[model samples]
Target: MNDGAPQGWGAQSTDGVRLQKVLANAGVASRRVAEDLIVAGRVRVNGEVVTELGSRIDPENDLVDVDGTAVQLDQSKRYVMLNKPTGVVSSMKDDRGRPDLRRFTQDWDERLYNVGRLDAETSGLLVLTNDGELAHVLAHPSFGVTKVYIAKVDGRVTPQTVQKLVRGVDLEDGPIAADKARLLSASTGSATGREESLVELTLHSGRNRIVRRMMAAVGHPVVELVRRQFGPLHLGTLPAGRARELTKVERGALLTLARSATSSTPAEDAPDTRDGDPSAE
Candidate 1:
């Protein structure tokens, strides 16, 4: 019951590129397949179902989604996931002569910056990109983008401690709480006989040194910490000090999150100052 041409074909603007061509150019699908998708009513332009095969859009200005996933039309944009190794500063440049992020980004010509910070001694799952809007949405605490951290802390952790973390704790800056918390494992050192426990926490706060501060408040200071996930991104098997381009699926998910966050209430204008050394908790 569908034709290649739709009812709005005559009224559409002739100034911009066709929808199918734009989708095809963005690697969403081949031109023919894109047309089929449009005719099938699976493609939306700016939140409206657009099935007219001849519909034109400003790829740079208009938002498009195919099958509920965001279509990134700008080819110049870059999204990278880095498993940051401990001891390297999160900054792109360090004036103190410490190891920085330059080595991982030298291959790309685009100037990129870390989305959020991981303290110098902590490691894992840092996103680097030139996409400022996406970075703001993911990094700002007001947006509540959850991050998963696995912390190795001193002393044996128990259910009570986990419950307290979930209930909340008061810190110097303010009260904070983990959205989710659990004890992964606990062991006693063979030589030193000191107890250690691995605690996995899910939090949406961007406070500096938040994980360390939280554990210390509960009588178990963090000895080591690593972020395992950021929003929809997972560290997975990515080795430390390595970087890779995000897969098409990953980028689509990330963009979709950013779009959703932007559509909600506007976040505070304060800069995420947690990017500094001894910060990014």
Candidate 2:
């Protein structure tokens, strides 16, 4: 974790830089871009250019020059949140040749990346920030920032399904379960009057395809899933694809929730995992 030494250097508190942060601090570009530099062999440490993404460097004494120029680390930090719509990937840049969120961030001076991921088919609140430390903690599985999602399932939900979810259902990720799951509302199909239900799911674990997979485990495959909240931050009134920065209060809420995680934590004013709420426009 010490960023100051790069082989043959004394250990010192030089504000160690994650290889990506070092690249970003060096003005090479955003942290994501810096990662690419580490991958491409363009970054030199001491007299040798390192191409490894896992390397760390101290800001002082560590001779890191990118592309033949000495990089001056910038000190300011930036944070942003997007009500990510479906079709947008949660990457800083995409190699799959699809539209990326960067286009929306062109107006900002600092580089940023998604703090946590949202699936290409899922939509809702996503935090984007340049504060690497904050992003690292929020997404860290041990910190356990709760994520709330509203899922539209394929058929009427059985009461057993809700109980199983609350009680915990086994998933490939291991005994995957919701911190809470409840039926918000159920309705007969509008045209066929067939059974369909809206269920709310909340959990602190971040696993690939978690919500969809959980519903499927209970015989109710998800037709659509939308995240409504992450920790104390909410998508409240933020329209799909739109974005807003975290307010002072909202940011404080996140930090407090992260530091004081336990049972009986209060929910923010954001929506929960309940179905039947009108879709956001």
Candidate 3:
């Protein structure tokens, strides 16, 4: 046996290791956070902005930077995708002793941080990694990383309801709205003499409990909610609670998309904070 020694992040296995892992090793942030910084257009490799979470870099010759500062990478970095189950908090550990992501990641033996968190009652795709810089922007609102969710609500949802959600909802914190919303297959079923419909929501906001609150405001309380997609990654048949590494194709497509996004939108498109930016912490 080869003693199961893990390969280093940049061992030239295939297109170098994931960019997030390199940032994580450089002490920039955990892999998840690293993805956020990249997606927020904060990190640069070889003097180009890289927003693609799936992008890779050659640590030997490439230059890496975060918010205009260079990063020195180390050896170990891990990226994992976990199909989060219900009743578990998104954090690595739960002080209240409730179910957490750690229970599902024991075998990997890596300190992976959750990328975009899902509430305990909600379940679906969850990304865990040692890259903290990427995780920051993916979760931040300014980056506008689209996250898609499907929710089963407690009423006969109508097109009018859908329109309202797409328009906007005034929440306690502030006004919020989904970028897109649609009613899935309308199945007529008998349950309490009322119809329960499935609605799909796509939004960029990362506010707390935003999805559940949005539906409730429109008179359709969410009975069940599950995240189906995040950016370029989808929760395809990976089985609930199971974890897997990103495929090569998936990684490449994401980088290509992020790079395109950066090129399309000029820096002036960002808000008044376009000038001197605060450090991404």
Candidate 4:
């Protein structure tokens, strides 16, 4: 299960690390959840159930199983940045025959999942990775990872609306607010003075279709939305549907962001469950 040598193993020791940490780093679940699994006797090492939370395991020489499923680190973890195009689903696979990212990542040998997701209508910087720990860290709102988006809306974005968005809007699930908002450009809409403009927004909430819902809540429905940045990684000039590996600097910044998370459990402000759409993720 380790990508090749089991993630984080080469840097540590073959004597193994805590079983819970190994499971967490491998992306089986979060460290806290992994502890729960161990306590519940759902995890095993070398054919013996290990209920101790602090048990160590040599991933190279030992076999780990969770509920009868073998677990290993992905030796070749991938951290990819894709300038996703519109009409492409967030997942690498599309079950309903709809367009997805498969066409954009057909050449990659290892199966990679989108870090978060960008619904078919939303496009921009989407990270793909096989590194379970990195993915979990990035997706966890406890990290407070900020993402930027450029939204083309039906009418001129108003300062009052921006303030409301920043102050926090009550979504169906809970309240969410923007970290920042700026008017990029404004012009006449398809109709006369109806107006249209591109507004830049940054937020960390991962609620489903949050941006669209937020804009519509303020009476300015979105026409087009493109993510400009995810954490410190910017989409830059990559063409639509194109993909590239993360540069060294970008990778470092992201790892830093992930490690900066304050806790293993979701923050109180985080949604109770993850919604596949990464509109504000």
Best by lDDT: 1
lDDT of 4 by residue, 86-204 (tens): 88887655789888777766678877777788788888998887666667666756677788999999987777777888898877878888899878888996665678988889988
Q: Which stretches of candidate 3 lie over 4 Å from their true place?
A: 1-75, 188-193, 255-281
> What are the lDDT figures for the candidates, one per model?
0.87, 0.68, 0.70, 0.73
Model 1, position 71: C-alpha lDDT score: 87
Task: Write down the RMSD of all candidates, one decimal each.
Answer: 4.5, 14.3, 12.0, 11.1
Range of the 10 consecutive residues with the lowest summed lDDT in candidate 3: 272-281
Off by over 4 Å in 4: 1-75, 190-193, 262-281
Candidate that beats the other on lDDT, 2 or 4, i.e. the better one = 4
lDDT of 1 by residue, 33-125 (tens): 999999999998777788888888777678888999998988888999999999998998889999998899987999888888898899999
Q: What is the lDDT of residue 197 in candidate 3?
A: 90
Error of 4 at 185 (Å): 2.0
The TM-score values for the models, in the order shown, are 0.93, 0.64, 0.67, 0.67
Q: 1-281 in candidate 2: lDDT tens per residue?
A: 12333553322324356767766654558988888877887876654677767676666546555654444333455556788889887666778888668876776787777777777788988877775555655665566678899988878787788999989889875988799998888887687566778899988776777888888989888777889988778889998878777774565565445334422243233211111011121
Least accurate stretch of 10 residues (summed lDDT) in model 2?
272-281
Clashes of 3: 22
The better-scoring model by lDDT among 1 and 2 is 1
